[model samples]
Target chain A: MKSVYIVDDSIISPLGFSVEENLQNLKNNTTGIVEVKDTSIHTDSFYGGLIDEKRLTDAWDALSEIASYTKLEKMMLLAMQRLLDKNPQLDITRCGVLISTTKGNIDQLKENNTDRAYLDTLASAIQQFYKLGNSPTIISNACISGGLAIAIAKRMIQAGHYEDVIVVGGDLLSEFTLSGFFSFQAVSPKPCKPFSKNRTGISLGEAAAATWISGSIKNTNISEVVEVVGEASANDANHISGPSRTGEGLYLSIQRALDEAKVSASDIDYISAHGTATPFNDEMESIAFSRSGLEDIPVNSLKGYYGHTLGASALLETIIAKHHLLANEVVCSLGFDELGVSYPIDVIKKNKAIAMQHVLKTASGFGGCNVALVLKKVSI
Target chain B: MMVEDYKITSFCSIKDNKVIVDNKVLYVHEEQGTVKEFTKAIYKSLGIKYPKFYKMDTLCKLGFLATEALLRNAEKPDNQTALVLSNRSSSLATDRIHQESIANKEDYFPSPAVFVYTLPNIVLGEISIRHQFKGENAFFVSEQFDAKLLTDYSRLLLDTNKASNVICGWVNLDSNKYDVFLAIISRKGNTILTEEQLNKLYHT
Candidate 1:
């Protein structure tokens, strides 16, 4: 019962440090992804979306005096601080925090001496830094962690566990992830082209996104409230590293999400897909869209701009989708020049204005995990 | 909202080189050895020929063995059964291995097989594939097993009709030490799956 609304949010990424800047970049078709030649991350130059180090340090210095925090922690805290700043009336002591991250302080493992590398320890640092009421729960379910965090927050609020919950998702580009993706040959040498015929692979990125989910929209400062209508996650039960050729898990997730939202496939206006640009991933998504009878809906993958931020990907895109609903426009799927995949799904090629009311966000990742969240716009 | 009382239909745990199902010790390895040897010994004792078990990392192997024992006699659960697992280390054992592969330039050969198991939820995926559980699932990482959180989440899923049955508990593996505690929670069973009871089972 209770309707959960994403009342306030913030995004810290390569494009910008705030949601406004990120949205402006999206509207201008400016991509944050570039050719990165950091030998510390990989042996060869690769494409990725990396936040400017000097800018990040300046932002952190302006906010806190705590210098011991890791880069990923600073990003998460900064994103949360921006959201909290927007809602001065929010009671931090009464809210629960859910952290969505695949590898928390994983880069610290290089020294092989830091205990803060543990996922729970990362949550503890955030909890102590904010003095929140409850110990922050860490969701580390591959790329679906962020979206699943939102879904879990919705359940917690609806079940009368917490009136409000703060969900923060962040991951960084490190030698660990880069080398692993490179090992799999999943890294693209150029800016990723999602759903494009010539798409190579995913361009890994680093970003942090935070959202305030509440049972009531009292202290919100937005014109339109984005309600988390329905959310569901399903496992492919197929392969660990590879996606299902039939898109079985993704189709189930979408179907379950739509059913729970009390809407049919036709009711969906836009789709924010997890287009990692890998040949198999894009093709799997296309088949899932067709199987769900949503082949004609305009779908866009923000990876063209933000790349695959891993755990931060779904939540970041969901926040952007909320902005799209508020502005009544569909941002273009950047880097897409030609139709790709066997199924004929309508991938958004250019930005266009539309009267969007409901949008679907889907993400599938390693370990055969797939999640879908339904968001609806409501006038206050 | 009307809340429903769910029960722990079956429970199993693996720790200290011993396998216990429903409070009964099924198998035990007397000699001290690595986690891999212990898990493989348990697999052989289970007498199942699932070769995929060999490919999984230690975490997945521990979780798979526990689940196999938990559902040995019970009827096969349908796809509506969701998995909600928690752990502390979060694949750090595998993460260190993956990190070591690329730590040196001369020996920089990161194998995809080893890299794929670097997530905590991959264990969930392994159990899902083994049981054909094509339903909602999530993996949480806490400093310790928080029975209250798991109970609350599992109840929410069952209350909302999102899942007919939920296999929820903790499976943690780190530094040659592994502990797995899993239980099937559903609408029908002899014992109510309360937070206190689940915690007691975990500690037992």
Candidate 2:
């Protein structure tokens, strides 16, 4: 497979809008989950990783072309603009943009009581706003959408179609999702605690993350950059919201990703698991990892710091893992004080020093969909 | 990604435990349960291994039933398979239910469980679990069906040996309407199809 590298990344979450700001907060264990004082908008005491209004406005000003966009669109444009600005060397024409989100401006539709054509309008808005004439692909694969976005870009680049692809994923905590999570009984009253013995449910977060991928794109002296080695998606066909009790879908996704990478379970240095803190999700993932004989690998979930950004989770997690890989350190699984599931696997609770090579990123979502990706550090 | 004979084994629209198939008219503006019920009825009659009641969704039930029928005649591919699901309205029904909760001030608690289905690709996840296919999978959205894009993507997956076989199709459910056409496309050296062939089979 052709090598695909991460050239640049930018993020806007509760922590801050820039990549460096988010990373700095993460190092200090600063969580973006907070109380929403505006309960009148939705009668729920839920926590969300909301972006600051002033920062968001400034970000919109930077990408003034999208000034007319709604709140969600502005948030997305801000992330994209920051990423594009960071990598001005690459020509946008030779690149393709892949946007991933579940409800692409769906909030606007709900507010206006419009029809389904709202999606088309959103796509057009993006095309005109970005000033890109090429066809841009949008993915809304639940929580796996962000990771799948990278996988799609890798396919296009590996197929010798485009050298560079801009992948931007974002989602907002609209009343639509707030009610959905509440109806399902999966919302955490407090901040989410992934893989915690006292864990209750996930905290919905809004975030936008952008990453530039290319064969030629590179940063200064960054040898051993994170490389997309392999990625795969699998369907559970077992349930809609509930995961397969046997972890069949997750097991298949992991197996396929490893096969594509031509690497064995023992080769992986660590695993950035999709520990959603939900009983079923954590249990299913543990069983799947054990089934794959990956029980010994160090693992952690970033939900404690970033909450579940839905479509943005996978890419955001990958960005965090990439930073860890580059720094030769392992991030602890925040909020995991106890092993809540029976499945046997080591969930890292402390930062450990190690020479990282290849790590796995796994995520599972509704409709029994699961995806696994392998990232290898490109050695000098 | 040349056209070849695409077999649709089981086309189901299920709800609760009931299954509906090709015989039932798919409603585009009705309750999700009606669609699920119609799909479940089809699976019951076909004698396929019935999925557990609680674990099945319209997407999984329909996808597996279709996949079972598509692969009934041929053996499972010896190599990994690619899954390409194209759509415009993905998991809208789930989104609707979620939206309703938020809209209702008295009962404004959005259930996290329902929130999970708001994702468009969960259908793909259901399909993967049913077939136990752990391979290259993607969900691409457009204003309308893009046959050229689908063909190109399928070709890319097959040509690169990403998967020896490719199961690509369009599955969408909005309101009560369910319109999906799935196909199993192996390498040209391995399989074959033409527009005339599909037109004759589905039309005539």
Candidate 3:
């Protein structure tokens, strides 16, 4: 099997437009989440990480494009362009594009004609924009879409389907998602506190995170390459909206991922968990980590900074994890002051320098889906 | 890479008011009606007492019924049976309903029940809970059914020992039009499962 390497990446979010800027903000412990008061999205004030519209517009304007595009499209296109620019030698014809999004143009739902609201339409627009070789595969498996896209890309490359795959995960904060989360009473009133005793619930956010995964390393400009060693997804088979109290699915996913990577739980150095901060979700993750015998590994949830970007959450977090591995420093699990869950997993409370080679990225979402991906740092 | 040979153990298709299993018509409604009515009729014919079926959106109902039919006579599949499903519309049918509930401020009342189905993969969860399948699963969206993608993915899972069995196909619903095609692929079966075979079954 071919080893999948993350050769290049980019992120467009409230914190910054590039990976370097985002990493700088993380190192400085700067949060992108803020109190959002947009009536168009919600009736009352809520906390979320929203990109500066003016800044985004200015960035898009610099592209000098004559075509009109939606906010989500602009974010996705800009992110992909940045990644492609970094790897100018990439052959577009041999590459495959995989889009991970829960809701593409969902904000376009209010219009009388919702042709643009289709997930495939969002993918087609990107395909046409890049004139890529193949139609983009759309992964809409809730929050796991982003991380799962990376897993599938690995499989596609290993199976000799493509030499390189570009995975882009993006979602927008619209009334459609906001009202739904509010209806579920899962939205936190303040900045999200993942795995904290006082944590209330998730803070919704919007972002576009893209990465280039190849069978062989490219982009010699980078110092180190992050290889995707093992990836697996499992369904809870318990509930669609709620996570299992036993964390059965997550445990299975982690075990399977570890097995595939030919590594033990003790081999993992850090964990980037899907700590949505909802009491049930955080607790479930703790239980799963305990079951996997990884309770001693330092775990951090970036939700405090970017909130929950839904489909973009995992990919964005993975990119941050790559940087963490490159820098050999683990960022703080922001907003965590006290242990919240019953299990005794080590939730990183402060940014600290540490020697790390292997990082585990896990995400669980609606439809009882859970994914675990094992990433290892290899020197060029 | 060495390829593994797999077979289609069972198959089911729900479309045009007809329910077909393994190339045999199991049930067909004579009267034209809404997707809701057609799905309800199919559920009644199946005679299974799963009350949760009533609450699912049209897409889930379609997928749920198709899976129930696919595994009706066969032995219970392994708990590690993965579900790889795809469709073009995604959960747009339920998304439209959720959008309508919150579209107007005066009538804003988004029910958690309706909002949960807004994701396409929820159908997989519903089927998983029903069959006690705690296995790998994924939901993909394309302009139309892509046999190569589904087969390639399912083959990867089987070849890598990630899944014991796979229930893979397309289930799409939009504007009252519905189509569902589900098949169980395993190491044991009569017909070989491949991209060409899946395409033929989908067209059938």
Candidate 4:
């Protein structure tokens, strides 16, 4: 397989827009989650982490001459624009864009509904704004779309599809999702506490994360990077919203990824788990980690700080993990005061400094989807 | 990376009141009803009492019918069958309905059952649960049915041994229009599932 490297990246979230800003907030334990009482979403107020409107629009207006993009489009464009501006050496013709989103502009249906509400339109808008050669590809595999996008990009590059691919994933806190989750009772009243004994449900969030992955080293301009060693996706054949009781799909996903990387559980240094903080989701991860024999590894979920950003969670978490791993540090699993699940797994509460080498990132979502990505820090 | 060629061992297409298998019409519905009612009629015609079929939106119903038709009799290891599907519209059919339910505060009652089917990949979960397909799966959205994209992705999944067999095709749905072109891509087949073959089959 061709060596796929993460060349450059950017994140636009409530914590901050740039990668550095978000990392600092995460390290400082400054959660973006706040108590929200938006009438458009639910009858009662719910806690969520929303991007500051002023900050978002201001940053977007700076990059875009006219603010014609939708909220989700603006977020995607901002994240990709930051990476594009930073890496001027990238060839526009050879690069492709992969967009991952569970709901892209589904909010567009709420008002001024048009064909533009479709996902491909959102992807095309970004592609045209950048004037890329290859048509944009949209990965819409529920919440795991972002993680699966990385895996898909790696394979496409490895198969000599494109030398460079830019993946930008984002989802918004629309009434559609909020109402739906509320109907499912999956929204947390407080900021989500993943893997906690008292953990209830996930805190909704919105974020856009962009990463430039290249198949060839010559295409990359970054000095320090992370290599995507292996990745895989699996289905539980279980419930659509509820997780499998045995974590069979997630365990298989992790095993397949490790099998592809030719690595074992002992080789993993740290784990970035998909701790949605939901009763079923957290327990599933524990069982999956236990099944994969990775129970003792230092594991953490960023949902406590960022909330569940749906499609953007996996990519956002991966980028943050890449940053911390490069710095040889492990982030805390915020809001986790006590272990909730039956399986014995290490869920770190505070940041731990270690000689980070290899890390495992796992995510499971609706439609019984699970994705496991193993990333190795490239020694510069 | 070089990958071994796989074949479209079996395929099914559903549109209007007819179901075509491998470019040949296999079943036609004489029932007169709306798309939902027709879907239910077709579901009954198969005589497979999977009661969950009625709850699905037009998207999942079409996917469920076509997939069940393709894998009705053929038995294989459930864990290796991947459900890789694409669409021009990403769950917009159900999204519109979902939007309608929540758009009006006066009649605000977003059914969890309906809201759950708002994602395009939920059909994958529905089918996986019904057939016990515990393997790699993904849902892609594009301007139209992109055969090359589907071919490349399925090849990757199969080549990596993540999936022993793949149920790949397009299941596009709107309020009135619906079409499903699902195929079984496996090692033990005659017709090689090349990009050209996929394009030809998708157009049917």
Poorly placed runs, candidate 1 (over 4 Å): none
Query: DockQ numbers for every candidate?
Result: 0.87, 0.44, 0.89, 0.84
Error of 1 at A15 (Å): 0.6
Better of 3 and 4 by TM-score: 3
- Model number 1 iRMSD: 0.9
- Candidate 3 reaches a DockQ of 0.89
Expressed as tens digits, the lDDT of each residue in A106-159 for candidate 2 is: 676567545532455566667877677866788877888898888878888887
Candidate 3: stretches off by over 4 Å: none
Off by over 4 Å in 4: A219-224, B73-78
Tell me candidate 1's fraction of native contacts, as a decimal between 0 and 1: 0.89
Better of 1 and 2 by TM-score: 1
Model 1, span A44-74: residue lDDT tens: 7888999999999999999999899999999
Stretch of 10 with least lDDT, candidate 4 chain B: B71-80
Compute each candidate's TM-score over C-alphas: 0.99, 0.85, 0.98, 0.97
Fnat: each model in turn: 0.89, 0.68, 0.93, 0.93
lDDT tens per residue, model 4, B89-202 = 878888888888887788988889888888999989988988898888889999888999888888877887778889999998887788889989888779998899988887
Q: Considering just chain B, what TM-score does every model have?
A: 0.98, 0.73, 0.98, 0.94
Worst 10 residues of 2 chain B by lDDT: B195-204
The CAPRI classification for model 4 reads as high
What is the C-alpha lDDT profile of model 4 across A136-156, one tens digit per residue?
999999889999999988988
